[model samples]
Target: MARRGKTAAKSNPSRSDCSSTSNSLSRRPSSGDVKTDLLQALSAIAAQHVNAGSIPLAAALQADLKDVLRRWKQEHASDLQKNDKYVYPLEGRYDAGESSIENVARSSRDPRIDISLEVGNLSGADEAVVRALQSICNELGFAIFLASVERARKTLDEEVLDEAVRLVRVFLLDGGRVAEHVVLSPSEILGLQHLLPRKLIIYEWAAAISALEGQGQEEVPAELSAWIELQLLELFGQVPKLYVEDGPALATVLTPRRLKDIVSVMEKFAGTTPALISFLLAIHSKEMPISEETRQAAFKAVFATMLASFDITQDPKDVRMKANEQPYRPRSLDPPPKPPRIPCLDSDSLVQLTMHVIEDDTLRHELSLFTSQLGAQTTRINPLDFESLFLPFLHSLALKTTITEPHHEDLRTLFATTITAYHDRFVGPTPPIPPSEPDVADGSRRWVRPPVRCTCAANCAPLNAFLADARRHRIEFAVGRQRRAHLHQMLDATPRTECTHRTLRGGSPEALVVTKIDWDAVHKRNVRAAWEGRLKSFGGWMEKLVGAGVDLRAVLGLEEYERVVERREEEAPEEGAKDGRAVAAAAGELRKRKASEALVRSSRLQNAEGAGRDVRRRVAETVAVVDLTDD
Candidate 1:
């Protein structure tokens, strides 16, 4: 009842005969046969759509995409195995930066650096905070590269590490968290780069602790630790930049203020903890010879105190930390090789320890900042005054046994570039209740700072007055002025004409000669001394120049006065010899020049004054009279 189809079983097969086939069977199509006819019709329709830049896909076709690929994979699995390559990559979402074929057939199976990282758990985070920390770490990386390593090395010693950790913890507890990435403040960072090492060390420590305590060990970031450290110092040249050779994280979270706080905390331990102190001492490549017993006792004391801090248990939510891990306590297990004369401390010797703080390069740097702020007025607090100002502070610091309190020497020494005998003492208010007296419940006689008085007044009068004057201008000027005043006294009161010059003297004008009997014989013998009659003034030498006018400055050597005269001369030049304007100008110039000459003469007398002040300055001015009589 069925008819044969035209589809050939073999090439060039003939068509089926329609005459022998039943009419009903031929007209009605079977399901399998109808599918072929349907497919051919759909293919033609699809071709039309394709030409029109449209694609039609059935639900089954779309859903079966993976399955279709699976089939293809199965068919090509042997070829794929032989080639050791991806025949093609599945495509939908990918960068087309490099000419994009659907797939990158080449296989680069080597390790990769993942710059793109998944930003998880930052949903609730303030983006600003994260960005800030990231930025800081990057900046600091350059400036503090060496310092970080040095700090880490110091931490290798358990005693130092414990102390250092404790300090960081305290700062964090008190006022430690930084808002975001930032550079160190100018006040701290401008003076010395020393803070870098300490900052770097703490950052590395924090980072290390985080890795251990769970900041994350998920994947090493695009930034390799070593590379980041190197970049921190080397790249950016005095600035900080992050080098992420391999990492998955977006940040290296350290900040300027945070680093400063951490450094301060560490510095606290630097004073008390043997570990920190010794490590610092060692950095100087010097030695402090201490007996075994003394060192042992001191270190043991530190250790015991540390243990007490450690005994307190942690919260249930926190991990069980190691003994030296706490930030509050510092431990010391080793004692000195030799025992000291006493057990633990000698107060006098301890007092001298304050000097080290004052001498510390880092502390000095901080102090330098104060001077910078004080500006030109820095001299107001001279070495002596500065030392005096900070004396009480230093004394108090000297009394402290712990590093918690700030050191006076470090702070005060900033102003004192050089201390001498002048600064050996400083005066302040004395308390009404001495240490020997009992405490006053009513607070009678409160102590107040007395006004600073001039020390020169204690012994010398002129020096005292000079000091008062010195408070206005430069001290050197004041001293010079006093010297000049003294010179005037020596020269003016001690008349030159009455005294013998012993050196260049030919003056007896103040003495009046009673008689001269040898005048007759002398005149007759010298009658021909002047054969030709000559006329001469009794005592006259031309004050004016041979041709032009005399220069006031050239004669007096008073530069300022010369300038004044020169300015006048230029502003009002002489016109004619008889002109009234010229006459007035000449007279004015003469008066000014005469005044300048007097000042010059007084100044020249400075050496004769010596240490005499009143004798030189109290005298009246000298007058020179020229004789106009003819002989």
Candidate 2:
């Protein structure tokens, strides 16, 4: 869904995508004289970026910026000369004393600093303008910093070989209808990546993303947001060399009192970007060892991060590594842990609750998915597993749906991810399909997808019913690469049971609707074997029995059966009367046979039952087998 470098560019600015990632979403900033506060925040961001990268200036270009400054000063001299007392006051770059950041943190409505300095007292016009210009510079790298300014942009546009300028001036500080600055589009940004330092663009946009995330909006270009988060973490991983060099500046701009809050917020935030997550943790935890509780989580996260990176969760080496690590650690509590719930899920309870899945008409795929994940450890799901797995999965699932709307495409994805997340504790690692592969068939064959969604159709009931049957019957998915190879050695591996149904297709009298056998499994296991040897021409043998004066109509009477079967336009439902038709006919035969006749019939029944359940208990088994249905 997202690539590393390109993500930020693809956040389609045209769509009204919510870009807010406010750390404190519920708490909104109140309206008032927030002018100074807004200015301070803006100034801090601007300074961080301005101080970040190379100020591109060749001898000629340096002279050009100076020339512009000289001309602007000259042009505005009349205005500057007139406003000697109070106009065009050169603002000073903020000097952060020990308590300056602290004081800023505690700022109420009015900031203590005097904003209206006399223009005459203002010493450095170039410096004040440069500092003010930092916000724009932070936004625009110095490589093209002056290109968008009124005079410079006009000059640059004439010779314009470039598709766009790095910065676009929406309006100017000229007191008319002008925007101070606007960021370039992604395409424009990429064009300039080589021209400007990557950090300049990274830090500038990172600050914007961080600030926007603080604004309580969601639904931005997910790829872009995710990329920024990851890159922040990536840079985080490289903390000391790049970021630590700015610690003093950070301390000055952010404040000592704000450290705890910053760290706390970052601790939670870094989880979004694993690249920086480890370093964020290491930076904070370098001095203080992680608590036992946090350690387990850290391991799981790091392990999953590694798995994601290498795509090797199922490797034997990984399993051994996981085995060595402690899986659970108790969290510290004010009081203590609560007593565990009792009345473990009984077989009857699981069965009874499971029936709802088979019978219910109202449940959605989300419910189906959630229910399936909850029972992963035990097909006959423990009710406690519902509380443990599904309940928590539902919470995240709900958050992903409502909070992270665009990401929650399938319910099964939520379920599969939940199962994978807790794989160590709850569902032991089974044959985990790759995160890239489909765990379930979307009902249609697909090679791979994110874990949760398997085969899916519009409706879930039949699928739900099928899964329930698999659960009840203890259908083990062949585990490991050798599972297929091992199948021949397991049990008779031959069909013993009679099928429960005979299915006829819609609009065709001769179509076999349902095989009554797990043909998909059978075909994969050994298709040729099904028709090989003794099982071949079992149909012809059945006809021979009927032709040899063995009155099959007496046992499988054409009258009642014809009347019952003809009463439908479409095929009968699963587990309908037809499901048990083969068994009914076979039983009928047994009942009619006398002891001596039964002994003689044993070999045939035994032979047929051994081939396939469908062959014996269903239409394929019976002498009166119909090739197709007339709808």
Candidate 3:
């Protein structure tokens, strides 16, 4: 687990507890006291350090003392300088040996005011040096330095103030090497919030909460615990903004485990911050477009966090009680019955062939028997039959078509001669040159020729015509070769259904694991919903802007509308012109039609009394027309 720093208490300090003083600084300074009282407070702190035998701290304090005296000199100017009693000479401010007890009371005649004069000289020097001085001062006594810093905060730049706040955290929260316990109160830590980095503050809150929780049921400081809880609640307010502006970048910095911890802490103290809820909605609502990896990681992080919340351990009731358990009893068992095994004939020809090749007599006999049975049940054909029968018939048809359809004589002759020559050269002799002695009485022994042999039957002429035309085309030849090879492969291949063995018995159990969730679908849905919501929100804002008289074109770009017009013209200028003309024509036609209707209405009214029944009927029809128009 990553360690987060503890937060300071959120409680406000009471006016009475804000300050305390020594005899040298006897009066509790009011807000109106300003510079003089602040200087006096510093002097008192220095005196106190010197009395406590912390020589190093006293020396560092002396440096601060001189800074106050010098500033006072500048502020007082000639009034103090001219009054010898009021002013310590300029040279005395630099030299601590000559110093401030001459004007003010001291516990010793020569208090060994061993101060690092260099620190006073380097007050306006390098920032690193200044910070080092602050850290040293913080270690000596946080109270005095914190008091001095609080008083001087207005005069300090952010750099110095940031350094001061960090020192306070280190000293107060970490308690340094010398401190036995936390040296600063939660209120003091909280007061430093103005100067502390927000990033540091949030982490400190997390760390403090973790520590409080680490103690389990033990008593904890109420103020500290409250501070941690408050910080956690407050931190959630920024989490959504952080994720939205730079979720991927932020994800790189934070581990899934760390995110889960943060989420867990938020849930424990503050049900859920609105910003965090919005962030989760954005992550889960597939409408928000994020990278697949990022979405998956976010999902995994949520899943892991939620899974961690479940107490998967066995329940107390579910656990068997050893005290009430029955003892195991040894018993004699009957001999196990053997399961009958039926022989499963292997379908692979290679296995059988290998057995025969190795001169296994039993396997060879079984293979011979299997082959004879298979041959008896199945019909077989020969490749040589196509060469002897089909090719000659197709060639003859092509030749016949060339003679009958003389328009394509050259092309048909070219196809028929090419096929005939190809068959004669590669496929040997044509029909009547039988593979074996053909029976004279029965032609069944000979190769079957087309008409009856063709699968297309009466449409064999069309088939021949197509084949004749296709044979001359280059693509057709390539296609035909491919299809022929495919057909051969299909015929030669063993069917899977034939491999099933109903005679076989016995089986082995198998386990299959499948997930119920479709993560891809979930991620897509989230992204889509988030995007749609965003679009709707944007659309509403856009509508408001347009309603307020903001021109979209001007807002988007000065020439946006012009560019759109130009693009439209470029794509289909003629189409646009035609549409415009059509609209104008339609408008003119509608106007003419409306004028005619008005004329008819006026004529009907004028003739209503003169034409009696016919005019009244026409007027009534006109009234019906008016009613329809009104509707």
Give the alpha-carbon lDDT of every model: 0.25, 0.30, 0.30
Ranking by TM-score: 2, 3, 1
Residue-level lDDT tens digits of model 1 in 1-631? 0111111000000110000111122122223322232222223223333343332323332222223223323434555432111111001111213312221222123113111111111111112112222223233221111000111112222212111111010101011221211212111111112222333233333333223212332333443444334434331233121111101011122223223332233333332222222222322222223334443433333333322232112221121112224244356686535521221112232233334534555545433443233222223333323232233332344244322224433332322321111112211111121122222233323211121232334223433343233122111212333443443343234332121111112332221111112233335434423311111110111121101222223222334322321222223232123477866777788789878966766776565543223221221110012211221
Candidate 2 least-lDDT 10 residues = 9-18
TM-score of each: 0.15, 0.18, 0.18
Q: Which digits, one per residue and each the tens of the lDDT, describe model 2 over residues 530-584?
A: 2222122333433443333222222223332222211111222222123477756
- Model 2 whole-model lDDT (C-alpha atoms): 0.30
- Best by lDDT, which number? 3
As for lDDT, the candidate ahead, 2 or 3, is 3
| Candidate 3: residue 580 lDDT (0-100) | 78
State which candidate has the highest TM-score: 2
Model 1 stretches astray by more than 4 angstroms: 1-159, 162-229, 234-282, 285-421, 424-631
How would you encode candidate 3's per-residue C-alpha lDDT over 194-313 as one tens digit per residue?
A: 322245233333333433333233454785556545654566555432211122212222333345544544344231122222233334433333456564565444433323332212
